[model samples]
Target: MTVRIVTDSTCDLPRELVERYGIIVVPLTVIFGEEALLDGVDIDAEQFYRRLAASKVLPRTSQPSVEQFAAAYRQAFQAGADAVLSIHISSKLSGTLNAARIAAAEVAAEAGRQIELLDSKNVSLGLGAVVLAAAERAVTGADLASVLAVATATIDAVHVVCVVDTLEYLQRGGRIGRARSMLGTLLNVKPLIHVEDGEVAPFDRVRTRARALERLAEFVREHRGASRLFVACAGNDGETEAFIERVRPDLPGTEIIRGHIGPIVGVYTGPNTLGVCPVMPV
Candidate 1:
């Protein structure tokens, strides 16, 4: 059976990998005042960040509509996929997974094939790692059940931590979750956060950006045994590469993939956000 993988734009998987793996990405909407644009489709990271800095109004994000997801599922089936394994961002973080669930039910009968939906309980590269694992398994001709098993294992093993420039973006975006309490307390410091139990939680606070980056390296050192490491940021100020260099001494001969924080996640984390996603061996 041919099992295809589907994810949302929030996965932050590189475009080449998405194309190479035949992974389908459904986009969410990013709204600015009265105007709305599709994340990763109509707007990209650079443009979104530029507008974010210049515009007086904060941009808002919305989950994809049921019709959009239904169309994606139908297209996958039309392309001869025997079954589709749809992995999405945490349902707790975004309603994207719920929309996918509704879409799956709507299209399953017409496609006459199984459409399995998975809530990754993570976002960005944290979610991307799981999707990549499942896609790799599917490309090896694994059945839907086997691919699902790999995805489940990856979701359980993956860990994500990030340091944002400020907590205001997250607070205004309503994604602060457990990190809400740190709002006023983080005035002069950088906030360290992690995805815990499918929601954002406070990790630590650093006095400087230099120290926060160092702490991110410490996080990788703690998870040195991870099978895969992905480092992502919102800017091109050489921070991602510099971070890898800083951590190279601690983890010799380990492969680290560089990724960019896409528009949707960037919408909340704001610019200059740096994060590390480590997928431990399952």
Candidate 2:
């Protein structure tokens, strides 16, 4: 039986990797005022960031609808697939997982099929790493349960830390309050945040961007032990480059993949954001 893997757009895996592994991506909706655009389908990352900067109102995001998942599952089953392993962003952060669960149940009833859904309690590269690992295992003829085990193990081991240039976007997205944002602005403080069970939360705070970056490296060095690393940057090439250079000496043999944060994440993080995600051995 052929096993297919599916994930939502927030995974932030590169398009090439998604296509190469035949991983299906269901896009989330980004609403700016009265306008709604699909995360990556209707609007590209570059365009989304551009609009985000120019818009007078704060943008909001929503998970994909049940119909969307149903359609994707139906198409995969029609192609003679035996089972589907659908992974999604954290249920705590968004309703995407619930929508996927409902769609899977309905599709199973109608077609007498089976779809396994996994909630990756992590977003962006954290979620992407889990999905990619599962897809790789599936290609090697792993069964649904085995593939899910691989995904779950990876998801549990993953850790992400991000530093945003401005707290305005986070405040607008309800991640931080106006008072906290104001305090950070007044103190020129950089907030260090981490993804816990897929929800972004405050981990620590520092006075300077340099100190925040150092703390990020320290966090990874202390917790990662031996693991692969994924680095993401938003609207700041210089900072990202500097981070890579600084960390290279410390992590002698760790594999590293670098990329930019896409629209869904960029909307909340804004520009000049630097993030590091580590996938510990499972």
- Clash totals for all models, in order? 0, 0
TM accuracy, model 1? 0.98
Question: Local error of candidate 2 at 90, Å?
Answer: 1.0
lDDT string for model 2 (1-282, tens) is 578898999888878888888888999998888889998899877787778779887888878999999999998789777799999888877889999999999998888878999989888889888998899888888788898899989988888888876677877776553235244343678887778756777777888888888998887677545467888877677888888888877876777878778878777888778888888888
Q: Could you give candidate 1's per-residue lDDT for residues 148-266 as a string of tens digits?
A: 99999999998899989898889988999999978888778999999998999999999999899888888999988887898888985488888888887777656687788988999
- Alpha-carbon local distance difference test for all models: 0.91, 0.82
Native-vs-model 1 lDDT? Answer: 0.91
lDDT, candidate 2, at 28: 92
Off by over 4 Å in 2: 176-186, 223-225
Provide the lowest-lDDT 10-residue window in model 1: 248-257
- Which RMSD does model 2 reach against the true structure? 2.4
Model 1 segments beyond 4 Å from truth?
none
